[model samples]
Target: MKFLAITLIVHTPHPATGVVQSTTERFREVLDNAVLAEELGFDGFGVGERHEWPFLSSAPPVVLSHIAALTSRIRLFTAVTTLSLLDPVRAYEDYATLDHLSGGRLELIIGKGNGAAQRELFRVTPEDQWARNAESYEVFRRIWREDKVSAVTRFRPGLKDAEVWPRPLQRPVRVWHGSATSKESVELAARYGDPLFSANVTHPIEPYAELIRHYRERWRHYGHDPARITVGAGTAGVYVARTSQEAVAAYRPVFEGNLALQKSLGLEPVFTTLDDFVERSSALVGSPQQVIDKVHRYHEQFGHTVLHLHADAGGLTRTRHHDSLTLFQSEVAPVLRRDIPDPPFPWGPVLHAPAPAATPLAR
Candidate 1:
């Protein structure tokens, strides 16, 4: 399976130091982390977009463009770009440029954002989010595929036989629709013959697994090859260690902080206890064997080719975060690489680049 390191530059206080990174430090860390993912043998790197208090990743295209300049081999992705609130023409132009800048190593995953604050900023109603998301994607797809495009969408510019500049490096850049709790997104993905990526961070496996089932069935209904259908899944958190006990003890405070944040948002918490957190949720906190077992179980449910692990500092110290990732790379990854099935696509070859500890990323 193809593995990716996904992050949202959330600016919260560090648990150990009780000090928050300055805007400068946060941005630098993001770039450093992306470069680190490349050096660590990660297949892909994704940055999430959220125009809210904690998240500093409102501009995915700009950040990705910079990553393109710094790194050579790792594919860059927008973990979830809020397409419903964007102007499709502008979004197409921006990403198309990034595709060239990155040497065609760009993948996009679009979604209707979760935050109400962001929806309000774009004057989008909760009820209209699905409609706008579908419409925006339609326009975006057309602009990317057609040289001279003409469209009159409600939320986008009415093109009068206009052509977008700097056509993408890839003839048609691959897109993955990101779905959390929406059937609309799933159907949209199936209808377009694009892949579906489940936002499995918020809930249990059953719901997301069912969504993938629906996507596959719809793919058949749409007369697309069922075998060609691709699915990508997200994990809640990750931390590998020498022993299960050590892993749990070290990650408990950060886990509690994550739960507290979810509670403050008034959303239902998925995993209530630490034991259930490790068992049910996608949080991979355990020894190498334990982590491998969990991943195999998830593959049984979703049959996904791509898996993304979120390793946010999440109130943990920077040192702890790096330790967890290093241990995971050294111990867990090699075992899974041999045991799990490879991703269906011929992704050419694994790429690596020099680490850039200096480049600053927007939080």
Candidate 2:
């Protein structure tokens, strides 16, 4: 299985101590974390995009470009680029440039982002959000694949033989659709034969498992080979220790703080306690063996080939956070890699052969 360390760049104060860092320090923390993920041999390092308060990830391309300059091998990902709120032309240009800057190490996970604040900022109605997302992706896909494209859409002005420059280094850049309780996203992914990444952060596994089942069913319905279907899953959080008791104790404060924050934001508290979170949610707080067992259990349900653990430490100390990841790499990843197989496609952009050049449209 491929392992990715991902962060939303949340700017909340320390849950227990009420301490916060300067914006500069927080940004540095994210960059340093990306470097560390590369140093520790993670397959990918992802930066999320959120335009609302408590999240500093509004500019993913900017952040990922800096990460690209610092790391050599670790693939950089937009945890979920808010395509619904962006112009596909601009989004395509930015990521396409990033693809070249990173030597084709860029992979995108696109979605209709959540948050009322951002939807209002972008002037997108709730009724039109899914439609906007689908249209944006359709435009974005063509922008990456074809040159001098002409298209008309309700969301943006018509493009007549427009050339989006610095085309993607990847022949057809790999895009994974981010799905959370949305059939539109799943069906869109199936229609295009792209992979699906489950935003399995909140609630129990059944809802997410059902979504994956739907994705697979639609993939078969679309006449795509079952063997070509790839799925990725996200965890609630992760903190591994030598024993389950030790892991729980270490992560208790973090979980409690998060639970309180969720209530403050008017979000429903899915798991009341840390024990419940570990039992129900995708949080991987346990001994190495226990963590492995939980992953295996979920694998049986989701058949996921890629797994992402929270890169943000939450309320844990930096030292403890570093140690947890170290332990995960040393203990957890090897066992899982032995048991799980990777997706059929290459993890990063395929760069050995030159992609076909785009032909100009006839006037």
Candidate 3:
């Protein structure tokens, strides 16, 4: 299975200490984490895009450009570009530039991002969000694939034989639709033959599994090859330790604090306790063996070959966080790599080797 490290670049105070890093510090930490992810052998590094408070990831193209400059070989991804709130023409221009800057290692995961405040900021009503997402994505895809395009879009100004410049380095950049609760996103992805990435962080695996099943059914309905269907899943969080008991004990404080914050914010609780959260939700807080077992269990239902682990340190100390990642790379990934099959298409940047020269005719 392919592994990715993703962050939302949330600027909340440390859960336990209540000390918040300055915005500059937080961004630097994100860049440092990207470097660390590459050093630790993650296949891709993702930066999320959010336009509201507590999230400083509003400009993913700028952040990813810096990351691209600092690293090579590791694929750069937008965890979920809020397509519903963007102008497709401008979004296309930025990502096209990013694709070139990253040496064609750009992949996009688009979604109708959640958050009432953000929706208000973008002047998008709940009723029209899904339609806007679908329309924006349609335009975005065409802009990438075609040279000149003309379209009448509801959300943006009509394009009349408009030609977007500096086409993407990849002939057609790969896009994964991010599906949380909506079949709209799933159906859209299926209709276009794009991949799906489940935002599996909030609830139990069953709901996400259902979405994947729907995606597969719709993919087949849309006349796409079943064998080529690709799915990726995200986790709530991860903190690995030498033993399951030790890991749970270490992560308990972080979980309790975060849950309390959630309650204060009027968010309905999903899992009442840490143990329940670990068991039910996608959070992987345990020994290497337990984490591995959890992933395998989800894989049985989701049949996903790509998995992204939450890279936010949360309440753990930097030392503990780094150690946990180190343990995962050293212990868990190798086992899962052997057990799970890879996706049919290349999961990372496609490196082409020189073709063999024609040989003399049996001289």
Candidate 1 vs. true structure, TM-score:
0.92
**Between prediction 1 and prediction 3, which has the larger TM-score?**
3
Residue-level lDDT of model 1, residues 129-178, one tens digit each, is 98888888887877677676666667665776788888667767788999
Per-model TM-score versus the true fold: 0.92, 0.96, 0.95
* Model 3 / residue 194 / CA error / Å: 0.7
Clashes of each: 2, 0, 0
Q: Pick the candidate with the highest lDDT.
A: 2
Residue pairs in clash, model 2: none
Arranged by TM-score, best first: 2, 3, 1
* Model 3 residue 234 CA deviation in Å: 0.6
RMSD of every candidate to native, in Å, equals 7.0, 2.4, 6.9
Better of 1 and 2 by TM-score: 2
Off by over 4 Å in 3: 349-363
Query: Candidate 1: where is the Cα deviation over 4 Å?
Result: 348-363
* Highest TM-score model number: 2
Scored by Cα lDDT, where does model 1 land?
0.83
